[model samples]
Target: MSALRAPASPGTRPAAAPRRAPLTSLPGGAADRGRRLDAVRAPLQATSGVPFLVLCAVILAGALLAALLLNTSMARGSYEASRLQAEVGHVAQDVQSHQEKLRAAEASLAERATRLGMVPAEDPTMISIEKRAKVGVGEADAGADATLGP
Candidate 1:
């Protein structure tokens, strides 16, 4: 005769109990218990116009800046173009006046030469006013080139 008791195993360990979370760690704790938290956030969730409004505001600001820059650049370009045009006009007038003066001087010289009876000789002579003499020549032949027909 023996007591009917089961043998205990020496290699097994006891099971661990389930741990509870700390009471103070609940979200918002006791302060969020009043009213409906979901209802407070309903307006934000239902509204779809906020993002569109923000996007429009950004685009409008960008357009305004672009317009301002374009206006400034156009004004500057116009000023430079007008200034250059005025300078060109002034230069053209100066050139015309110089051309008239040159024509008048040529006319005056021709008239003076005619009044002095300096006739156009059949054989015209050329005299060199340079300090150097002709190289490799016994006599300086001046009118040799002029004798050739134009």
Candidate 2:
């Protein structure tokens, strides 16, 4: 019903939308402080050419890149560690196999020596030396020959 109301007749011309209210300076009230804040924010808004959403996107992209780089480095280190561990395992297996072969060889040598009438000598001090004087050169004394049996 006031001057700002729209026309009721649809057949007539369409009424224009009301103009926005003018900017007004307010007192030191909270609403006035809010307007003052807006007034102070205007220059910052004008100077900040980049939009907030775009800046956030750029920051997110940088963080993602850094994360990706760190992930790649960690993956490479993990692979290297796995490879070294495998190598160590392989070397350990080789050492075990070699030790087994050495034991088998020592056993075989002892068996062959026993077959050929070779035996480990007893304590040299326990043998009597009197028989050594009677035995000719290149001939083993009777006491020494008795000690040589398997």
Task: Count backbone overlaps in model 1.
Answer: 0
The residue ranges of model 2 lying beyond 4 angstroms of the native Cα positions read 1-45, 49-58, 112-119, 124-150
Residues 1-150, model 2: lDDT tens digits:
476976578678775999999976557765755543443344533556568879999999999999999999999999999999999999999999999999999889978999999997553333336543322322334345434223
lDDT tens digits, residues 69-142, model 1?
99999999999999999999999999999999999998798679999998765544453435333333323454
Computed on alpha carbons, the lDDT of every model, listed in order, comes to: 0.73, 0.73
Q: TM-score of model 2 relative to the true fold?
A: 0.43
lDDT of 1: 0.73
Top-scoring candidate (TM-score):
1
Q: After superposition, how far is residue 36 of candidate 2 from its true place, in Å?
A: 19
For model 1, the stretches where C-alpha displacement exceeds 4 angstroms are 1-48, 111-150
TM-score of each model, paired residue for residue? 0.44, 0.43
Decoy 1 TM-score against native: 0.44
